[model samples]
Target: MQDGTVERMPRQDDAIRNLTMVVYILQIVNLFGVPGAIVGVIINYVKRDEARDTLWDSHFSWQIRTFWWALLGAAISYPLIILFGLGFLTGALVWCWYVYRIVRGFLAFNDGKPLPR
Candidate 1:
C-alpha cells in the first residue's frame, strides 16, 4: 500500500545445503562399499553443530542414526552368515532398510523440509 516493495523470506545457507547433499550422495554410493558411508558419517559429526537449529540439522541427525543402526545390523547379520547362512536374509533386510532411510532423507532434503524427529 505505502511502498511497492515486496518482502523476501530468508534463505537457508547454501554451504549447509551443499554439505547435506554431499552426505546423501555419499550414503547412496555406500551401496558399493563402506568407505562412502564412513566418510558421510564423519562429515555429519564434524558439521552437525553448524546445522543446529536449522532444517539441515534434522537431516544430519537422520544420517548419523542411519549409519550407526545399519552398522549394528550388519554386525549382527554377518555373524549369522557363519552360523547358518541366516545372514543372507538378515543382510538383505538391513540393506533394504539402509536404502529406505537414504531415499526418504534425500526426498525430504530436496523438498526443503525437516525430517520428523
Candidate 2:
C-alpha cells in the first residue's frame, strides 16, 4: 500500500472549463438580440490560444464556427424575409440549429469530452 495521495486538476484546467461555460451561457443569452454572442466569440478568439493543443481547442473552434455560421444564416434569412417571407421559417430553423449546437457543446464540455473537428 503506497502512501495516500489525491491528484487534482490543475488550476488552468479549471479556468478553461469555466470560460467555456461562460461562452455557452452567452450564446444562450444571444436569443435576446443582444451583443452577448459577439462578446462570447471575441472571448473565444482571444483566449483560444490558451487552449491550443488541448481538448478545449476543439470547443473553441466549435464555438467560433457556431457564431459565424449562425450569423451567415441570419444574413441570408433577412434577404429571404423581404423577398418571399420564407425567412421566418428559415430563421426559426437557424435558431433551432444554434440552440442545438450550444446544448451539444455544453454537454460535451460538461462531460470533459471534445467536440468533433
Candidate 3:
C-alpha cells in the first residue's frame, strides 16, 4: 500500500438502509410502480435476519406490512368499484395511507429511530 492506510467501505446494513430509502423516494415520485416496492420488500426479507434487535427490524417489518396491506386495500377497492363505483374513495384513501407510511418510515430511518408501535 502507498501509505499503509485502507479505505473503509460502507457497511452492509448501511447499504440496505440507503437502498430502501431510495425505493421509498422513488415510489413517492411515482416513478417506481409495483416493481420498486417488490424490490424493497425483497431487500427487507434478505436483510431481516441481520437487522434483528436493531431499529431496522421495525422498519423492515413496517415496510413489508405496508406492501401487503396496500395490496389488500387495492384489491378490496377494485371489487367495490366494479360492483358499486364507490371504490374511488377507498382507493384514494389507500393511496394516501401508503404515502403516509412511506414518508413516516423514511423520516424515521433518517433519524435513526424505529417505527412506532
Candidate 4:
C-alpha cells in the first residue's frame, strides 16, 4: 500500500463477469429473438476489452448470432412442418443445432483459449 494510493479493480474482468451473467440470464428467457440477441451483442461490445484474454466474448458473440438464426429457422420450419405434415423433425433439428452452439461456446470459453476472430 502506498500513500494516497487506492487499489483499483480490473475493469476487464468485471466486464467479463457481467457479460457472462447477462448471456446466461437471456438463455432462460426462451424467446431467442433479435431483441435478446441485440442485448448479447451489446454486452459483448461493452466487454470487448477482455475479449482477447477471455474467449467467452467470442463465444458469446457466436451464441447470439446462432440464437437469432435458430429463431428464424424455427419460425420458418414449424409452420411448414404442420401444414405439410413433415412431423417435428425440422423443429427438432433447429433446436438441437441451437443447443449445440451454446454448449460448444461454453466449452470453448471454459477452455481458456484465445478468442476466435
Clashes of each: 0, 0, 0, 0
What is candidate 1's lDDT per residue for 10-116, written digit by digit as tens?
55567788899999999999998757989999999998888898889999999999999999999999999999999999999999999999999999999999997
Pairs of colliding residues, candidate 2: none
Indicate the worst ten consecutive residues by lDDT in candidate 4. Answer: 25-34
Question: Which residue pairs come into collision in candidate 1?
Answer: none
Better of 1 and 4 by lDDT: 1
Candidate ordering by lDDT (highest first):
1, 2, 3, 4
For model 4, the superposed segments whose C-alpha errors exceed 4 Å read 1-8, 28-57, 114-117
Candidate 2 local lDDT, 1-117, one digit each (tens): 257877775788678778888999999999887779999999999899888877888999999999999999999999999999999999999999999999999999989999999
User: lDDT scores for all predictions?
Assistant: 0.93, 0.91, 0.79, 0.65
- Show model 2 residue runs off by greater than 4 Å: 1-10
After superposition on all C-alphas, the RMSD of every candidate to the true structure, in Å, is 4.5, 3.6, 2.6, 4.5
Worst 10 residues of 3 by lDDT: 26-35
True-vs-predicted CA distance for residue 54, candidate 2, Å? 2.0
Location of the lowest summed lDDT over 10 successive residues in candidate 2: 1-10
In candidate 4, list every pair of residues with a backbone clash.
Answer: none
Candidate 2, residue 85: the lDDT equals: 100
lDDT of 3 by residue, 1-117 (tens): 589999888887787677667666655654235457777677778877877776677888888898889889989999999899999999889989998999898889888898965
